[model samples]
Target: MWPRGDDDIIRSNSLHESWSTGALNIDMLFPTDYFLFQVAVCSALLSAVSPLRPAYSTALENALRNELFVDRNYSLLQRPSQQVDVRVSLTLLTVNELNVKDQFLSESGYLSFSWQDSRLSWSNTSATSQDYSNIDSLFSTELYVWTPALIIENSIQDMSVISDTKIPMRITQDGWVFWSPSGVYKVSCESDITYYPMDTQTCYLKISTWGYSKSEIGLSLEIGTPVDDSFYRENGEWDLLSVAGHPPIVNARKGTWYSSLGFSVTLRRKPIFHVINTLFPVILMGFLIPMVYKLPTDSGEKMGYCLTVLLAYAVYLTLISDDIPSTSKTVCLLSVYLGLTLTFSTVSVNIVIYILYAHFEGDKEVPAWIDNGVRKFGRFTRREKRDQNKVKPSTKEEHCDDKKLTAILENEENNNEEHKPITYREYSDILNTFFFVLYMAAMIILTIIFLLPLLINYLTNG
Candidate 1:
């Protein structure tokens, strides 16, 4: 019935099961070769052709290599009869530095430019007509520049952008090439730092074609929305108020006239940081000079405090000098204030020396004129100072005992009574009160002289 014994038993069982259940288990009898044949046929049909296409970047490069020409303006490098009027605009990304001393500006931005190439133009070659134009990769091609002689004038250094665009510059069917390159430019600019931290400064960026005259190369800046507000970034110390561009330059050099497009940037300095760090502390120290005179001459700290304040002002002056531009033509207002206060400080030191000298007089009565002058300043009595400074006055018993001792001394030395006039302690009180009044007056005058003009200026400006 069957070739093998197991097959013969299985075939009989299957036939019985089929008659009993009307169902067949045919997989148990299928041959391995037949299964393999079916798999092979399916695999061949599925893998008949590849679904991939050529890469876009490669196709764009091929299109550029095949069509666009970039070397056509070389013959007229020396004597050019015709020139392309290129339209240009700039989008600021960063303002690196506006050097006041060096007279230059460093900037980074994207330069948007559009120009027509006669050789690259196509008519009826719109996006629908060209198959490659429909594909985005075909437009990403390295265009050949026919005119390498064309260059930017008034560019001090490094006009070319650091990072070039990888996406090939697209050219419309009408021969318009819209190209934007990211560039870093350093242009020479004139600045006036007269007011410095509070000053508003204006710098200019000029662009023009080099080696080509007005008739050969015509340059015009874009008009609408000239400075891209969204693209501009913030500066740390300066606020950009406005940026305006126009063609305002007609420079003559070596018997040739050159025209240029000018971009003026108006900026104001943010002075809060400098005021807090360098100016406020110095002003506080200047106001503290009066405290030196308030100390009694015996404390011996009046000169020390005066000198310390003077030295502090000196240090601040040095600090500010190192940062600002080194020019004597325009001196800062803060410097003048420091100089005046420094003079007052020097005078204060001398006044302290005089007070110490007068306070130590040995049994010499102060002259009538000095006493009269002291009275005119109003009485700066020892009682008032002792009470105000919180210094305790000697008890009443101490003065009574001193008077008794002096009476006994006078009785013993009656022969020298006519020569002796007043004690040193009494003389000191008179002089101290007079000079103290004078020192306070000086402080008030100095403060008013320094601050009045500044206040007036602020109110007037506002």
Candidate 2:
């Protein structure tokens, strides 16, 4: 009689029935139920000889056939039979050609991957059906949606890339697609039989594709290694090995596969020759104006010329603001040049006013009362006209006698001497001296306030 348990009856019937009958009945029973009973009996008989079996013979055979398998789906079969865990590694190669759409606004580069595997599973342990759809869309490709944990290591040091082969890439209506001469492969078991097997086995997958017209690219690998609680116990640290290849010539850096490869681009203003051409002349003009102050103020034309330069600098300052970014902190050299020009122009104005005033007003003698008080303190004083008048000839009595002397002196002077009138040239000389002294003083004060502070600030910041 058949055993009481349905499972025992299935197993016994499978062993005793003819092959044709059993094959026909196999579909009637649940495949898992039949496989479980067979596995129990097989475990008892094959435990001693199981170690002798090849570690990855079926997996290697699949690899030779250009077929790849992952461990996730296979785990369900192994779990019922309590089989040993298995691990496998695969390598993939991809070549990419890129074309940048906007060279001024964007840049282009290529990505090459050396090793890629299909066994690694994602870390979304609590993923719901919605989460799975989201993640699948994120990493889906035109040919297949690989649920593998991709590890990327960037060998490019100077440049950065956006995606590697094993990235969470998604397909959109306008999204990138992968094309291969060999058709794409889907998930499958390593066994030649159509039914899932209870035996434990590991498989490796190698995928190769080229990414063209890409903004940036990188390389990475995937594996079936599970990340447990201990994996996250410490900081998530991963060590990645790099395959053989020369580093990219562009701005690149050596990076590890433990983290995702990332890239970001910014639009920068290109250095324009026309902009420099426009600015260079303006800055030169501003600097040149300060030198005009060195011309002697006696030239009389200095003030008019300096005013014209100051106006030009102001106009240039207005124009420059349109080109440079508003948030830039750098004080333009042009601004400094314009400031110096304006300051010197102000000094020029002061000098012109001073000279014009001194020209009109000659030095006036201090009043007698003020002079007397000043002299009491023992300060030096100029001789007053009153003091000179006091020394006039006291001999009025000799006036009559002097009158005869004066008449004879007048007669001799009229015959031998001619009188010359005095010129205002002395006043002009005095005005020049005073105005120059004032100019020197103003310059000294400006230097103390503006130049010294600038020097101190520069040195401290530097």
Worst 10 residues of 1 by lDDT: 383-392
Best by lDDT: 1
lDDT string for model 1 (375-421, tens) is: 44423343232122222335753666767766655454433423334
Say which candidate scores most in TM-score.
1
Give candidate 1's error at residue 22 in angstroms.
71
Candidate 2 lDDT tens digits, 1-462:
323588867765775564556554545445665687688869887875543323334443343223112433433112111221112222222211111111111112223222222222222423211112122212333224322222222222222222343343332222222211121112221221110011111211222112211122332322332111221111111111122222122222243122222222111112234336553465356454444435554677666776776677677667654643343333444345446656766666665555455434545433455334433432122121122112233467356686776776545443332222111232333334444454456545544553454445333323
RMSD of each: 14.9, 24.0
Clashing pairs in 1: 70-144, 70-145, 70-146, 71-146, 72-146, 161-183
Candidate 2 has a TM-score of 0.30
The superposed Cα distance between candidate 1 and the true structure at residue 151, in angstroms, equals 7.1
Candidate 1 segments exceeding 4 Å error: 1-83, 98-104, 124-143, 146-168, 188-191, 366-462
